[model samples]
Target: MKIRKLIRDNNYNEYLMDPIYSRLLENVNNLNERIFQKNKLVNLQAFMEGFTFYTSLNYRSTPIDVLPRIISSEFFFKISNYLSARSYVLNKFIREVYQESSTPIPDWIIKTTPYFRSEMIGFSPPKNIYIHVYGADIVRLRGIPFILEDNLRIPSGISYSYKAFEYLTRFLPELSEGYNVLKPNDLEYLYDILRYVSGSKDPTIVLLSDGNYNSAYFEHRFLSDKLGIILAEPNDILVKDKEVVVKTVDEGEVHVDVIYRRIEDLDYLTPGLVKAYLRGWVTIANAPGTGIADDKATFVWVPYLAERYGMKLESVVQPLTFCLYEKENLEKVIDQPTRYVIKKREGYGGIGLAIVKDDNLNILKEIFKEYENFIAQEVLDFDTVVSVVNDSFYETYADLRFFTYYDKVASAVLSRVGIVGSRVTNNSSGGMVKPLWIIQ
Candidate 1:
């Protein structure tokens, strides 16, 4: 009864409400209450705590129904394969966008954004990989998965998800027993990817970050340490003799062969650094100028790219995107702006989003008049899941950020759930990050 009461109105709860999983939920809650009373629950606080600057994660709440939420291996494989297929299609489309192909999009949209790199027109990264790392956001609406955004620049949350899985399962080992947990060697895989790009056996690798000002700065540091790569800031980067090098305290200026860069935009790249990358002196993961695929407008073309490349994007539903640059689409959105969620083309982290209740349509109208850097998608009522907030149980909509690599179809998944009234499932927006375990 306790577990059933915790269950939301989603269709999948019947399986969770089964006798076996219901007991698992009770056991997890019992463990949680015991730890809550004895103050042992604070043990898991170390992961999100210990740093004042990185407080974006909503540790105030977490999910207790691990068994119910652990997706089936069959579902996992389908989603993973879907992302792999889509990633390959997008990568191929990007090559056409840059190098050459009969254009799927108008040339005007291409020249408008700063992401279109004239210099990289004929240039290709090592292994011909434009997107070394990729990720996409998926929100299930009425049982159909819809991709919210495409992350080609820096597909974060791999480390965070892995860290949670690496420890939280150990903290509550009972929840992990029945299922075959799929734990891949993330750090080693990353190391191998970097090494492969570097084209060296003993190449020096550096994890480049925007520094402590970044909200995910903790992840940058954590990944660097785990992957056995030096963490360096933008200022720490130097281009000497057309080669990229990083200044480290332990070693005076070490030559960097591979840079696992996390900069948000191409604006973060210095001219010299870009020159070095273009000249093939060093390799950058995801490569520079890959953000074109990250544009929300570009997302509107994902399905088209899939169709053109003879690939299937059926792993999830494609949100109906209103490309605002077109006259009719722009008019429709401006007329009934609240009917859709208006998003900045290059925006990330769930920022710069406007919807019906925000009551900023007038302001949005003026902004749209000057710039066409916005796209509208019909509002989606995502499916809900059981969530615990401040020790209280309730229902919440969920968003999953499943990671994809150039080589690996899907590696890990991180789920975030926003309670009944909340719209955004981003951790920074008071949404809680929940661990997603794969049912073996």
Candidate 2:
């Protein structure tokens, strides 16, 4: 089937009777009971055991009864291959933009945040791969998957996708029986990239975390255990002799070759650590300063960048976006506030996102006066999918987070669904995650 036809005619009822779907319904029912158990202590314990840091304090059972979102094998391959190949071009483009301080690339777009303006200009990473790991938020609208934004710096939730797939296969084997579901090999790919950049056969790899207090600390721990590497906090690592090292109780100070950093803000990292990365003494999975490419304003120029770099991306869809730095675009956004989504250039997890409406014009006008670091994007009327919530199924807004390594799909896609009335599809924005599977 053609990609557009499949997307337009998407219907989960085709697999409603699948044994896997039945099993998921049963498990979710049980999960509901477990979550609402009469004993508070028991419920809390189950919540902690089941969710960990995957959810916030007000934990809710995620609906997994619906069929996994399906895409044709051909369509999947096309987009995946395109994104993978485009990564190289994007890396070079970003480097050139930063190097020359090009006029076409606005300073507000590249230097959206203080952390993004790095003084290390001549320095390059070990492999020249600025974005080692990327997660692109894609939304299907009018039978097309549109790239909402590119997460080039410190993207999370790959572990969630892997775990979801693991749980599905282990708990509902029948659902996966005949389907050629893609297995997540992100760890192997990540390890390969780390080793390639390290120039060491047995490089000491560490997953750096801000601390246990961070929300994603669970994922940090999970990836660390899964990758069989040390999980270190900022205090656990120190700069010595121009090299980043991790202190261990049993092994003393260990030389660290590669760091899969979970922390987002570069400023939070110690000067020594940043210096080591800048000096090329140590390698980071996503090289520092890559945040310049992830700026929301920079996303509006991806298509132009692709064309300039001699890469063709016919499969990728993107919404109409305009940087607020332009007066005409700013005026257009102000005039049609309800038709656009205003966002901070450096915001993540729905922190500074607002669906501007007539009523919010005054507030936005004040914000615009105070901040030029915003972008206006056409609000996407994304397609809806069946999602189970509170023991009932409802069509909810959904988005797919496609994880990429270099330029290839790394793992199973992570599907995030918003609550029934919610528009945002981020877990932090009252959204829940579902496992994504490609039907062969």
Candidate 3:
């Protein structure tokens, strides 16, 4: 039995080791050996260093276990199909939304979604591509998986995906003995999609970041370095006469073909900068104003959007029960607050989410009154699974985030699962990750 001992605080001799730990260790060693043989020392070292970081971080990720959930190829195929359908639906919806202001999006919903910038009308992307990379959080209830949210903006953790394959495969050999884990080659595929959208053979690509203050700065740097692209700060880019260009520290002016902007909104951009983007001087990965589509209000219409586009695929997620902020709906939601999860329209990373319990109804009602900008969703206490904690065991909530890339040719996806204390299993909120295997 290959098990590594993990001792918790105040317990040195009282350590716990599952037999599976040793198996994982063996697998990691084998993967390291393979990478070491095939790649340059620098590449192998960077990869291994990332693996080590993730491995060490997992232990500190609350009182949860790191067990491998084997997925069948059959299930993989199903998930892939669903993701493809979702991509199609989202792409079509974004186009439709931006193309027409007269398009009847619900009146009550739009009032709450501040991110929906109407300025994006008639502004098509350089290609019919938006959301080239997608990370959708999903959860399971009674063995049925459902989507929680769609991540279109600067979705991080692909670097971790590449590293984890090397780490987990070498660490737990037995787990892979009969399983076919999805390959990590998809990162390059995402890059290729972006390049195609830019329509250039050797497009001068730049990964734009909001300086180092952003949480996913390390991942951005890793991607740019690996892809052999330039990483630029907001100050490093220059838009002149409705054209995009890069101004390096030493080099004067270099033309830019594509801008993979990781920066959200910047206050310093002149009117000329935005005009350059609108003119398609450089291709943007997510394209501006895409944040509008991922709003909770917009998400509610996904199933309808799918149906409208003649897509027969049903949503993996059940319709989330929400109040429309109307007088009738508000009264209903407030009267039975305990059964819901209150969320503000423009919230992120679990900021404005409150689980309304019987004991907190009065407080919750007062909160709703003070912060009148809220939509209450029915509580989705999804089922849990067991993961090991040293020698003892504990159960933690988990969510699967599917990564998708879309080009004119096709839309494909890779998925990752996060497990930890957070009901919202975003990595920023203390979640350990595992790969999503394609069932074949």
Candidate 4:
């Protein structure tokens, strides 16, 4: 078989003999060791510095011998534009459907999460932009990439992926040679969004973290340092005189005009702080109640919303999704369990997700009894990527996490691959990371 065919078939022996694969594999082995040791020491230092959750879950490691998933520049630009336009349509839908009290918005979309309360409904931000940062998870099935889910609120992993790219380019120059790889400047775009929303030329920006115990605290710290902004935990901030301020030993109380928050649960924030945000004293990157857009049930209506808003998404491929709240959809999913994957409406970190196959029909039925807000999607068999674990080569399922800043795609991508025999490709759920590259 040809090299591509060999890779597709997971023929390890042939891959080992291919000169290009062998050289790349050798370089990756060295790069992996260096990164492993460096990450180990950095993680230890981070833990000491109160990044307690950085290494606690064993999800921070760098995977080995995985070639960067290559995409053409044409496809990259097309998809980015599609997602950007789609975001506008989605935002319009949210504003039109959920902004008015009398409008009939689906209860499952807004009420699925506790954070989307009545008080927050109709609460419009300065620009009516709900999703400033979006992480749209795309999976390739039968050589076509389909958007699996949209994460509108507090999308993590951009900083991590950017750091990983820096490491790759710094340590493995040989691998990046001859390829027109694009580097992501997400920090700039992020700052731009903050500036735009704050309506300030040089806004006082602060990255809010839940605490050191939050799983993505390392990323919070990384972003704060990289973007040259203050990293404040929930306790470090307070609302005084209707303005959000961060307390510091050096400056006493520093006024914060824009806050790029990393926390998902809005309940953890003080009422005063939320009030300050609502009053426009402070701007939040992803405004509160934006979780409705990320809710799994809302994903079923995304294409329809886009079309209704007169936005064409001809280049985009959305997976066939059904909201379980509908009786017909529920029966359809329950009858043919193997044909679909079920997920909770507000699920995150790969939790409350199940892939129903022939063997798990009975179990899924029992599980379904407990879930009122759920979504079922057509089963997509993702393309396999080569990976090396313990010096042995194997093929694993992979998906791409494409980050977008205010409807523009971030230049870099974070690829997550599942372990052998697993379907889910979330880092928190034992998935490994790989760098993605766009070949011009």
For residues 1-440, could you state the per-residue lDDT of candidate 4 as single tens digits? 13344465653332333333454545555564553444444434434544323446443443333355566678788789878987786677667655765333466556555546466666888788878898888876655668998888888877656655665565456666556677776578777888899888988899988776677877888888878889887888988887889987888899999988888665556556777887889988788777767778778888877777788876769988988777788888877888998888878878878888623665466446855677888987766766545434556777788888886788777877787667787767777666677666
Please provide, for model 1 over 226-297, each residue's C-alpha lDDT reduced to its tens digit, 9 standing for 90 to 100.
877899988889998878888889878988898888886544554477778889999988787788888788
Instruction: Put the candidates in TM-score order, highest first.
Output: 1, 4, 2, 3
Candidate 1: where is the Cα deviation over 4 Å? 1-3, 6-23, 29-32, 35-44, 47-68, 265-271, 357-363
- Provide the overall lDDT of each model, using Cα atoms, as 2-decimal numbers: 0.71, 0.69, 0.59, 0.71
Alpha carbon lDDT at 338, candidate 1: 72
Tens digit of lDDT per residue, candidate 3, span 196-236?
98889878888888655565666678789888888888877
As a TM-score, model 3 comes out at: 0.78
Error of 3 at 407 (Å): 6.0
Clashes (backbone N, CA, C under 3 Å), per candidate, total 0, 1, 19, 0
Of 1 and 2, the candidate ranking higher by lDDT: 1
Using lDDT as the yardstick, the better of models 3 and 4 is 4
Predicted candidate 2 versus true structure: per-residue lDDT over 1-440, tens digit per residue: 22223323555332232333443344444454442222233223434555445344643533342335555566678778767866766687767865655635655555555446456576667867778888888877755778888888888877667666665565445445446766666677777777788889999998888876676666787778787889988888888887889998889999999988888764566556777787777888788788877888777887888887788877777789888787788788777688988888888988778876423565586557745788888887766765545434556678888878786676567888777766688867667676677655
* TM-score, one value per model: 0.88, 0.85, 0.78, 0.87
Once fitted onto the true fold, the runs of candidate 4 whose alpha carbons sit more than 4 angstroms away are 1-66, 102-108, 111-115, 358-367
- lDDT of model number 1: 0.71
